[model samples]
Target chain A: MSDKRNSETLPLAWIMPGALLLLWQASSSLGWLSANILPAPLSVLASAWTLTLDGTLPHNLGVSAARAVAGLLIGGGIGFGLGLLTGLSRISERLLDPTLQMVRNVPHLALIPMVIIWFGIEEEARLFLVALGVFFPIYLNTLHGIRNVDPQLIEMGRVYGMSPRRLFRRVILPGALPSILVGLRYALGIMWLTLIVAETIAAKSGIGHMAMNAREFMRTDIVVLSILIYALLGKLADSATKALERRFLRWNPAYRR
Target chain B: MSKNNGAALTLSQVTKRFGDTPVLHGIDLSIAPGSFVAIIGKSGCGKSTLLRVILGLEPASGGSVASDSDAAHARLIFQEPRLLPWASVAANVAVGLGERGDGPDGAAAARQALADVGLTGKADDWPSTLSGGQRQRVALARALVSNPTLLALDEPLGALDALTRIEMQSLLENVWQAQGFTALLVTHDVGEAVALADRVLLIDAGRVTLDQPIYLPRPRRRGDPAFAALEGAILERLLDASVSAGSR
Candidate 1:
C-alpha cells in the first residue's frame, strides 16, 4: 500500500520539470527562444549523445569523479581524525579548536588563488581546493556529535565495566554517526560545487573544462549539458548518501522508512 | 535462570563532595549478600549520588566503597534505558558483559538475558521501537546479562506511568529473588521502595536518617492495609525529613 502511494506521488514530482522542458522545447523550435542563449533540451541531449560517442563525456566524467572521491577521502579522513582528537580530549580541543574555528570562517573558495600559486595549476591545486571545501563541515559536525553524546549513556557504559575502547566503539562512535553522516551529505554538495568552480578555473579535462571549452566556440548546448551533468551528479551523490544512511542507521526510525 | 551469589557491600564513613558542596557526608552502610535494599530520599537528597559512589561511577572523597564481587561483576541501570540507539536489543544487553561481549557465546547469553526479563523475541528490536516500560526491561536485561553480583538501579522506573511502575516493581522483585543480586535501588517513590526492597534507607541532610525494614512477604498486595500502612509511615518520614531540612 505504501509502495502504491509512493508510485502515485513520485510521478507528481516530475510534472513541473517535465512541463518546463516541454515549454522550452516548443519556444526554441518556434524561434521564440534563440539557440545562442539557451538551446532546447533535445539539442542538449543530442550534444550529450555526440559527446558520449566520441568518449569525451565519459573520460571527463571519470576524471571529475576521481577527483571528488580522492578529495573526499583525504579531506574527510583528516576531518574525522581531527574531530576525534578534539572530541575525546579537552586538552586537544583547547589547543586546536580555536585555530580551526578561526580558519573555518574564511571562505574556502577565496583560497583558490593561493592554491594555484602553490601547486602551479597542477591537479594538486584543484584537489586541495575541493578537499578544503569538504573538510570543516564534517569536522564541526563530528565534534558536535561527539560532545553531545548523552553523558548518562557514557556513565552507564562505565558502570557496566566497558573498557575504554569498547565504550568508544559501542557507545560514542555510533552515537556520533548520525551527525557525521549529515556532514558527509553536506560535503557531497560542496564536492560538486567545489569541483565545478575548481575545474572551470584550473583543470585541462573534466565536465567543467568541456563547458569552458565550448564557451569559446559558442556551443551553448554543451554548456547546458555540463550544467545538467552537474545537477545529475549532485542528485547521484545525494542518493548514494541516502543509501549509506540506510545501511549505517537502520536502527534509527527516521532512516528505516 | 542461573543465580550467582550477591556481593556484600560495605561503605565506611564514605564522604563525597564536588568542589565546595558536600553531596554525601560520611555515609556508612553495610549491604548483606543476596539482599535487596532501596535508597529513597527527596530530590537533591544525595541518594542518587550515594548510589553512583557505591557503583563506582564516582569516587568517595573520604573513606571506602568496597564490594565482595569483582568490579567487573557490577552493573548500573540509569533512569533512562541508556541503550545504544544504533544497536539491537541483544547487542545492547551484551554490553553488560564488558570484553566478554565480543565473543560468540555472548550472543546466547544475551538472548537468555532478554528472556530473563520476559523480553522474548525482541533481541533484534531497536530500543526506539520498544515502549518505555519495554526499554526499561531491556536495560534490566543488560544489567542482568553479566550475572552481576551487585546491581545499582537509580530511579529506573521514575519516568514510567503509575501502572507500568507497578508492573516493573513485581518484575524487579522476581529478578532479585531469582538472581540473588545485592540490588541497590535509589528511588523517590515510597510505595515502590516498600514493594520491592527488603530494606529501605531514607537519606536527608546527606545522611541515612531512616533505615527501615519492610517485613511484608513476597508478592505483597498493594491493596493490603499492611502495605498501605507501611507506605504511609515511610512517606510521612520522608516528608518530615524534607520539611525539617527546608526549615533549617
Candidate 2:
C-alpha cells in the first residue's frame, strides 16, 4: 500500500510546473500574450537547446559554477577557521569579534561599488563579492556551533585525560558538526545569489552575463533560459549539500530521515 | 608502582571554594584500591563537588588529593551518559582510551569493553539510537575501556529506571570485581549506597558525617534484613546531620 502511494505521489511535485508550462504554450499559440515580454516555455527550451548546441550555455554554466565554488571555498574556509579560533579562545574573541560584528552590519552588496573601484570589473571583484556574501553565515554558525557544544561532553573528555587537541577533534568537532553543516547549507544559498548579482553587474562570461547580454538584444527566450539554468544550478547545489549533511550527520537522531 | 589493595585515594584537608562560598570545608578521607565505595548525601550537599574535585575537574582551594597511581589512569561516568552523539557506540567507548592509538587496536578494545557491558553487537550503533539504559551501558563501557585504576561515578545511575538501575548496579559491581579498579560512586540513593559499596560515606554541609562499612556479601538482596538495616542506618545519619545543621 505504501509502495503504491509512493509511486503515485512521488512525482506529484512536478504537476504545478507542468500545468504552468502547458498554460504558457496555450497562451502563446492563441496570441493572447506577446512573446517579447514573456517568452513561452517551449521557446525558452528551444533557446536553451540552440545555446547548448552552440556550446554557449555549457561554457557559461561551467564558468559560473567554478566561480561559485571558488568563492565558497575561500570564504567558507576563512569563516570556519576564524569561527573555531574565536569560539575556542577568549583572547581571540575579544580581539576580533568586535570588528567582525561591526562589519557584519553593513550590507555586503553595498560594497560592490567599492569592490569595483578596488578590484575593478575583473573576475577578482566577482569572487570577492561572493566570498564576502558567503562568509558571515558560515562564521556566525560555526562560532555558535562550537560554543554551544555540551559542556558535559567536554568534562567527559577532560576526565578521560584527552589532550586539548584530541578533545577538540573527538568531542568538540563532532558535537559542533551539525551546526557547521547548517551554516554550509546557508552559505551555498548566498554563494549563488551573490555570484549571479556580481556576474550580472560585470562579467565577461557566465550564465548571469548571458542573461544581461540577452537583455540588450531583446532575446527574452535566452534570458528566460539563463534564469532556468540558475534555478537548476541552485537546486543542484542545495541537493548536494543536503546529501553531504546526511552522510556526515547520520548519527544525529534529528537527521535520521 | 604497587597495586596495593587499600586507600588508593587520600584526601588531606581538601577544601574547595567557589569565590566566597566554600563548598568543601577541610574535608579529609581515604578510599581503598580495588574496592567499591559510595558517597551519599542530600542534594547540594557537596557530594558531586567532592567527586569532581577527586576527578580533578576542579582544583581544591586548599590541601591535596593524591591518587596512588598516575592521574591519567582515572575515569568518570557522569549522571547523564554524556556519550558523543556523532560517534558510534564503539568510538564513544574508545574515547576512554584517551590519546591512545585508535585504529584496529582501539576498536578491538572497545568491542571487548562493550561485550563486558553486555552490548556486544551495538558497537557500530549511534548513541542516539540507544535507549537510555543502553546509553548508560555504553558509558560504562567507555569508563572501563581504559582499564583505569580509579573510576569515579557521579550519580551515574540516577537517571535510569529502577529495574535498569538495579541491573546496572550488578553490572557495575561485577566489572569492578573483575577489573579491580578503585570505584567511588556519589549518589543520593541510600539503598543504592548500601547495596553497592563496601563502605558508605555520609556527607552533610561539606563534611563527612558518617563513615560506615557494609559487610554484606556479593549479590546482596534488598529484602535482606541486614541490607534494610544498613539503609535505614544511613538514612537516619543523613537526617540527623540535617537536623543538627538546621538547629545550628
Candidate 3:
C-alpha cells in the first residue's frame, strides 16, 4: 500500500542518481571524457575530502548558507509584510503594486553591476542582489493568495463573531498558506541562482568563489564538487519547504502525510 | 440552554439596493422569541435578501432593524457549509466561539455540538472528507456551538438529496426544540416550511404576500391533512406567482 511506497521513496529517489554517478565515474576512468573538461566522481569526492580536511569547504559553505538565510529572512519578511498590507488595503495596493510589478519584470541578476557600484563588492552587495531575487515571487504569490481567498468563508468567519485579528489568523492566513509556500519554493530557487551569480562576479568567500578559484587553476574536480554542493543545497531547501507544508497543511487532504 | 436565549427581531420598511437595482423593497416583519419562522419564495424573490438585511450581512438601504440579541449572538447557516477547509471538524465548529476556538474549553463545546449533530466520531476529520449532508451537519454544529440567540438559515438544506434533506430537517427540528433559539429558515420547499416552522411567510417580487401560521404539534407529520393543506396552499400561491411573473 501507500505505506510501503512511503518507506521506499528515499531509496527509489537515489537509484537513478546512483546509476548516473556510476556511469559518470566509468566514463571519466576510461578517459572517454578528458579530466580538463570533466573530472571523475571519485576524484571530485577526493577533492571534497581534501577541502574538508583543510576547512575550506565547510567554511565557504557556512558563509554561503549564512548569506542565503539572511537574504531569505530579510526579503521574505518584507515581501510577506508588504503582501499582507497590499492585499488587505486597496489604497496600499493601488499605490505600491504597480511599482512592484514593474520591478518584478526585470531580471534581478541584471542588477549585479549597479549593486556592485553601490556597495563596492561588500557583503551588502551580494545580500542586496539575493534579497532582491527572493522578493517578488513571495510578494506576488502572497498578494494573489490573499486576494483569492473565498469571500464567502471570510463572511462566515465574520458572522461567527471572529474579531479582525482572529479573522486573519483563523481564516485568511490558513487559506493563503498553500500559495505562500509555493512562493517560498520559487524564491528558494532564485535565492541559489542569485547567490551563485553574485559570488562569481564580486570579491566573495563562498562556494561560487571556491569554484571560480578552482576554474582559474584548472582544478575541474573541485569545480564539479562546488556545483554538486549547490545542487545538494537546492535539494535540501526543497525538502525543508515540503516538510513545512506537511506540518502546516496537514488538514488539507492534498498535503496530508 | 433556556428559551431566554432566543432573540426576537423586528424590521420595518427594510429596503436594499445594489447600485441601481433594488433587491428588497420595504420588508416589514417581526419574529417572536423562540419561534421557528420559515420564509419561502422562488429564486430571486428576495427572501434571502430579506434575511440578510435583517441579519446585518447586507445593510438595509432604509429601515429599522431591532434585535433583542447583539450581532455576536446571531449565527447564519449559508447554503454552502463554508467550513474552513484547513481546519478539523472540531476546530471549524469551535470557530463559532471566535478567539477561544483553539482553546480547550472551546474544543469541549465543539465536541458537544458535534455529538448533538450525530457527528461525534468525525471531529478530527477534515471538511473535505465529509459528505455534503455531513458537511452541512458540521455547519449546523458550528452554528449551534456558540448557543446563538438567533439562527438564520438561508436555504441551508436546499442542495441536499430528498432523503438527506428530510433527515436534516428532523435534526434541525430536534435542535430547535432542545436549544430554544429563534430559528429563521428560508426555503422554496412548501413541505419543508410546513414540517418545520411555526409560521411560513411567502414572499413574491420583494414583498411578503402571505404570512400563514402553523398550529401543528411538535414533530408534525408531513402526511397529516393539515400539513398537506398548508403545503398545498403555499405551493399554489408560489406557482401562481411564477406564472404571473413569467407572463409579465
Off by more than 4 A, model 2: A1-5, B1-7
Cα displacement (Å) at residue A37, model 1: 1.5
After aligning candidate 2 to the native by TM-score, how far in Å is the CA of B17 from where it should be? 2.3
Give the worst 10-residue stretch by lDDT in candidate 1 chain A.
A154-163
Off by over 4 Å in 3: A5-16, B1-5
Candidate 1 collision pairs: none
Chain B alone, TM-score of each model? 0.97, 0.95, 0.97
TM-scores of the candidates are: 0.96, 0.95, 0.95
The TM-score measured for candidate 2 stands at 0.95
lDDT of 3 by residue, A17-50 (tens): 9999899999999989899999998999899999
Model 1 TM-score relative to the real fold: 0.96
Lowest summed lDDT across 10 adjacent residues in model 1 chain B is found at B95-104
Off by over 4 Å in 1: none
Query: i-RMS, every candidate?
Result: 1.1, 1.1, 1.2
Clashing pairs in 3: none
Please provide, for model 2 over A136-155, each residue's C-alpha lDDT reduced to its tens digit, 9 standing for 90 to 100: 99999999999999998898
